[model samples]
Target: MYVYDEHDRQIAAERVAQFRDQTERALAGELSEDEFLPLRLQNGLYVQRLAPMLRIAVPYGMLRSEQLRRLARVTRDYDKGYAHFTTRQNVQLNWPALEDVPDILAELAEVEMHANQTSGNCIRNTTTDQFSGVQVDEVADPRPYCEIIRQWSTFHPEFAFLPRKFKVAVNASEKTDRAAIQVHDIGLQMVRNDQGELGFRVHVGGGLGRTPMVGPVIREFLPELDLLTYLEAVLRVYNRYGRRDNKFKARIKILVKALTPEGFAEKVEAEWSHIKDSPTRLTREAIERIQGYFTEPAYDALENATELLASQRFDNRQFDQWLSHNVDSHKKPGYAIVTLTMKKTGTPPGDVSDTQLEQIAELAEQYSFGEVRVTHQQNVVLADVRQDQLFELWQSIEPMGFATANLNTLTDVICCPGGDYCALANAKSIPVAESIQRRFDDKDFLYDLGDIDLNISGCMNACGHHHVGNIGVLGVDKKGAEFYQVSLGGSSHHDATIGKILGPSFAQEDMPDVIAKIIDVYVDNRKEEEPFLETYRRIGIEPFKERVYA
Candidate 1:
């Protein structure tokens, strides 16, 4: 919803021109692979097993219809006919030619989008709740702050390269931790103090990957004005002290672990004392300037669609199922947030064909004010869909393979394009997801099983965010064979928890059966109306482990 200002346009265009020159030099053999590695990475290009992968940033997962259409065109013209949406709310063009990426970036620039800072150890995209401004119980819209941070972090000269990659997420809603702020490098929770003044509750050093850990609260409440200054202090502390001796231990999480949360906070506070009142502190004028860009759209005076939607629900069971799973209550009475499910069986999760992308762009324009939100769960969001038009919207999307009613069900899996495209992957994640989806094809069974978050990562990097899923699956390497490891009871909600592995890894073929047994344990032991996670936590992982390993 934030349109690019003229400044934004000029900066993006200049960066593309610079990159185009760099790309030309690289292709002409003026720069070697090692020389171009960091250069290319800074522009979000990675050389995978098959071809170069170009990650295009979707700032805070927000896109306009024009941007989506431009992306569709890029997928059609430059790389393969499809692209994969990532958990970070970015899209990866897997088969992009090295020479063609500059053109891709130029095209993205035309739409106020780019691939900058998507890789190369700088702060990645600043993500927030997909339903940021629309969620019913939201404390505040976090996107304004997310956008501020995005602009601040885009090419900060001081933080261009750090010990390791950094991530930041903001959550303005206490009801659901949809942004998974607890598991980010810097997690900011918007809160009101006892005096009713708004501020941030800061959490630092949380991350997944080789070392998985939840963030610890560094500051109970930092004044809103001090956000940028306090963050500068945290980054300065980390940059000064974080280990560069070993790449594996270089992340701020490792430093936090070494310092302990109390010590990390103390260091950050010490650093902050020197700069708390610096010019870098956000001013009321600046804050309002950024917030102005996210003002609400001119909503129509429409009646709530309760009666009509209920009637449709009664008439069509399929539509009813989709309505239950994919729809979320909106702050506006007559509107709803609908997640266009991307987790269909057989196809890789988070993937969309060129034609499908074009259609989604059209649908967004027609039904949701020409806007779309890319969800961290690998789905697309039509945040302003009229409740009255749910049936028609579903009909339009269903034919394009976007109307799976398994929003949080087992089949609504979050998965990475693993061995298929990623050279770093130990095993194939798409097939694993497909197998489980196929096994649980029965709709009634999935619905009865209740809300479950199933995430699969190809490796320990946790690209699919497997660590926080209710049922997390990680592909492992076993004696040169691809084996699957299972973790249970993980969650990325208000009570976020890391999953625990269930004994030995199994052959790829046995994963579906293993997941089925885990579900069986839950189904058999759960209390009336208990969600899978609640049931798992109540019985503990022992029962599921015993059953899954049996």
Candidate 2:
């Protein structure tokens, strides 16, 4: 994790003071609601359906244990006793009083955290794989690049106010697309040429909303030094020509569609040619300095605990299942990456209580290093857990309601705070997610079903990233009544694709059954050991549609 220096601390303190004044003025009736809207938004405060929601950025999803404890304290003292983790790898306080937000910002500043750029039409938090440096297959750690992007984008005067919100993601893994870069405003996939020179395969206009799209490859190879300059060029083009007259069509994806990929690339290239040699070009020293912050921790020289783990797996069926589902191979020999799933059957997905947050911080400090990473799937990750201590960690977290053993299963749903919080939502998303989880409570059945990415969103804004789920459930409004629409064959991995609509929307009551039918179709048609996504692609959505709509 990158520790804040004096400069960073000073800026954060100044922002807190500025927002305090702004908030006080608004509360005093000195600033109108309309006048305070942008100012509050810049500070990541939103007036939601019932109360104010404050989003706190977890830069590239990294957090120190101290920061987590600070968040727990904030939740306990200021807001409700719990907070929601978002798919963008950020955390949200759903019940903060409008007057208490400035105080909350001040609290966050003490821990080197803030709510800046978590909302509004500006560059949002840059995210990457939760298992960035620890994962086995990545070409190099992507967090340094993500940090670089975050520094360049945060409060950049040129891009302070864009037509709409812009999101950027980086992926360095050779085999996985955990970052889902293809669906971001700017997706940077680290790659190397024949001479082993590091560069990025850039994708632009990838987004999911009313208009879903897998962003096209704008530049096949952008050199490492020009990363910031290339990004500036892209933003410049979008700021100049992106739609502002209509909020619905203001995304950079919309602008790219209107201009076509080639035309958009030409514009970006022309813009880049003029400013490519500017000071923004990252130097070797600068890149190395950022990279230094993310170097490996003090890892012990130990071999994998193969024998002990095997014995443990042989003894406990439940622990074995958890190991298979929640644990991932680490780049280090003796370590493993563990995901603390938030999707328990009864609890709302991603909602962590204050007590649990504090406990998790302790667990991170005791088991892994004193650092944690938030995943895009709304889960917490202990990225450097020793393989030998897997069972104890699993046992500890299981009782804490964090060890669900449903990672990538149908029950591990990605969902958003819909009508329950967001005024923009057409229906409630949490209930739908809970209903599905409850219907598939059998752990054995879920294990048999294999990997599935099921996402739910309350509306077309796609905050839940429903478009990329293997089975996507989207809430829709029909004559003022809430309805649920289903989509099939969507994926957020390396071969990303938008899900196809199954059929006519169903009533809320039919969602569990509808999902059941789709699962039944996959089970009946799939080859032995095939995943849900592969089966859907091979057999096509027609079979699932027939089973679901029939």
Candidate 3:
């Protein structure tokens, strides 16, 4: 909910003007594709399998009603009538003309949004928990810190052209909703010491792609004020020493593995020695000012319990189903967090139509604050819905096709816009997700499965976070035939781990049956309604692997 300051406004506008000129040059053939590639990438444009894709940054996944409307308008006017919300909490417009990108950026700037540093070797968006301010277990709100880092990393002269693209995430919650301190280039978790002072638990080298590894803790408790300076040290060491000859080996994860966690920490510390208390360190006053921007919203003091809500829950079994799946507790007593499930049966995981976007904007204004959040799992969040209004909100959401009650069930899948939209993908991921959903449409059975995350990536890049899903499916091609590979036990939680593959890949036709076998193993072997993950951990992959392969 941080409004753009005048300085932010001016900077965004100026960047758009510069890009408009660059766009003109590129279209006129004054600049070749090679010349425009880096520039376009810096502005968040990528030439995909079908067309040029423009990624618009949604900082920390927060968006005002006005901003959402602007995005809707941009897609309606410039590209296709829909945008794909990415796991990084950004939106990708799939069909923007190369010439019209500058106009799109200008429109985004009007809403205090931009695509800068959304790609390239500089730090990408500094994501935080989607429920940052509203989560019941927040140790501190992480947005202000995210905003600070966003400013520092945006077009930083020193880091603009790194050996490879870098990403960072921070979490300030007891529970890790942001999946921070996991498979990130750098992960920061906020903590309080024995003396009750704010600090960070720093993790270095974790990354996902062809290689996935959980980051190792390097610094146990870095003080709050030294965040920027300490991060500068980490980046400086990586920039100076990370491999430049091979793009595959250029990520910080590779360097961290080569140097070992202890050695990486030492290198960063040696670099930090000269600049530990430099002027770059965030000041108390500055932190306070940034924090002020993220203060909690005003709420009515009336009790939240309602007879209408109770009666509706009693009257409609469908509403009750949605309530069970879509609602989450809020830090505020009178409020709740509502996830508007985009994963309706048989649809693309995160696709929303232009009309649906407008309706969501209206629903956000009616049921909660005039704000919505795009979650990493590609669902929209109505973060401040009143508990009393849950049923009516569900009714409004039902007609818009947003009332799928499968928040974290097997149906709530995370899938990339694979071969359908992305050229990098070897096979289509969305249809595979739909196939699995169709096979598992039994509501009672899915609910019994309990909090499962099914993620599908079209390729080895792991963009869909396939490696961390309780049920991960990756699509690969063999001799012009699309095959699906299954992995089990991967999780992105307090006990994070990448999953192991279950033998050879299966043909697309065999995937649903393969999944059924995996589930059957869990059902037969589990102890008293244990979740899929719990069962997997208890019995290990051997049981499922044996069943599937045998």
Candidate 4:
């Protein structure tokens, strides 16, 4: 976690004061609703369907235990007693009073957190793998780069208000992409050439909305030093030429489509030529300074607790299942990365109560070096848990409702707070997610089905990232009735692809069965040990479509 210096603290305090004044003016009728729209948005406050929603930025998904406790306090005192963790690794409060937001901002400032650039057509949160530093297979930890971008983009005068909201993601792992970079406005993949020089494989124009697209590779290799300059070039081009006439078509992805990838690259190159050698070019000193914030923690020198873990697993079936699903191998010998599942059977996915937040903070402090990481799948990660303490951690978390053993399974759904919270949503999404989770409650059945990414969004906004789910569900309105649309073969991993629509929409009541039919088709046709995604690709969407629509 990066601790805020005096400069950072000063800026955050100033922003809070500014927003406090703006909010007071708006409440006092000195500013009208139209006048207050952009101001509120800039502070990550949105007027939702029923109430105001405030999104708090969790930069690159990193959090200190103290920060988590502060969030719990905010949620408890200011709004409802819980908050939703978004797919971008940000946190959203669904019931904050408009007047209380400035006070909330002031509280967040004390913890070195804010809601700036979280909304309103500006560069949003920059995200990466939750396991960034702990993953063994990565070329290098991408958090330092993510932090660099976060500092550069926050309140950037040049990109404060783009044509539409822009998102950027970084991925350093070659084998997997926990961060869905391919679907961002700017996606950077860390790579090395034959000379062992670090650079990025850049992708542009990737997004999901009414028009879904997998961002194309715009540059083969952008040198490490030119990271900020190249990003500035891309944003400059978009700011100059991106659509502003129509809100629906204002995303950089739309601009890239109209101009074509080659044309976009040419424009970016021409723009980069003018300022590539400027002071924005990263230096070794600056990069190392940012890297210092994310160096390895004081890890205990201990061998893997292979025998102890084996004995524990042999004794408890529940703990063994949790270990298999929620635990990941860490780069260190004695440590393991544990994902605290937020998708319990009855609870809304990713909705952690204030008590749970406090518990998580305590657990993080006790077992994971007082640090936590939020995953894009709406889960929390204790990235440095010792292997020897796995059983105790599992037992402690189970009572707190964080030990669900359904990491990549069907029950571990990625969902959004749809019509229940958002004015933009066409239908309610939480109930649909809950319905699906309830229908797929059998642990044995889910374990046999294997890794499945099932995402649900209330509308085309794709807040749940429905486009990338192996089996994606979308809420749709047909003649004033709520219906669900299904998509198959979608993935957000290294081989990212937008899901294809299965067929005509089904009544909300039929959603659970429809998903079951899609799974049935996959299970019946899949070869031995094939995951849901590979099976869908091998068998194609036709079989699943026929089963689903039939």
Question: Among all windows of ten consecutive residues in candidate 3, which has the lowest summed lDDT?
Answer: 173-182
lDDT string for model 4 (52-90, tens) is 999999999999999999999999999889999999999
Residue-level lDDT of model 1, residues 1-550, one tens digit each, is: 6789899899999999998988899889998988888888989999897999999999899999888889899999997799899998999999989888988999989888899999998899999899999998877889989988998888999998899899999999978888899899999999999999999999999888888889989899999999999999999999999988898999999999999999999999999999999988899999999889888887888889889998999999999999999999999989999999998788789999998889989998889988999988989999999988899999888879999999989999999999999989999899999999999999999999988999999999999889999989899998899998888888877688899887888898998889889888988999999998889878888998788767
The residue pairs that clash in candidate 4, if any, are: none
Question: TM-scores of all models?
Answer: 0.99, 0.99, 0.98, 0.99
lDDT of each: 0.91, 0.93, 0.88, 0.94
lDDT of 4: 0.94
Better of 3 and 4 by lDDT: 4
Off by over 4 Å in 3: 306-310
The predicted structure with the larger TM-score, 2 or 3, is 2
Q: Which pairs clash (backbone N, Cα, C closer than 3 Å) in model 3?
A: 49-423
Instruction: State the lDDT at 528 in candidate 1.
Output: 98
- lDDT per residue, candidate 2, 1-550, as tens digits? 7888899999999999999999999999999999999899989999889999999999999989999999999999998799999999999999999999999999999999999988989999999999999888888888999999998898899998999999999999999898899999999999997889999999999999999999999999999999999999999999999999999899999999999999999999999999999999999999999998988899998899999999999999999999999999998899999999999987888999999999999999998889999999999999999999999998898889998899999999999999999999999999999998999999999999988999999999999999999999899999999999889888888899999998899999899999999889988998999998999889887888777767
- Residue-wise C-alpha lDDT for candidate 3, range 97-145, written one tens digit per residue: 9889999999999988999988888889888778888888877888898
Evaluated at residue 451, the lDDT of candidate 2 is: 87
Q: Which runs in model 4 stand beyond 4 Å of their true positions?
A: none
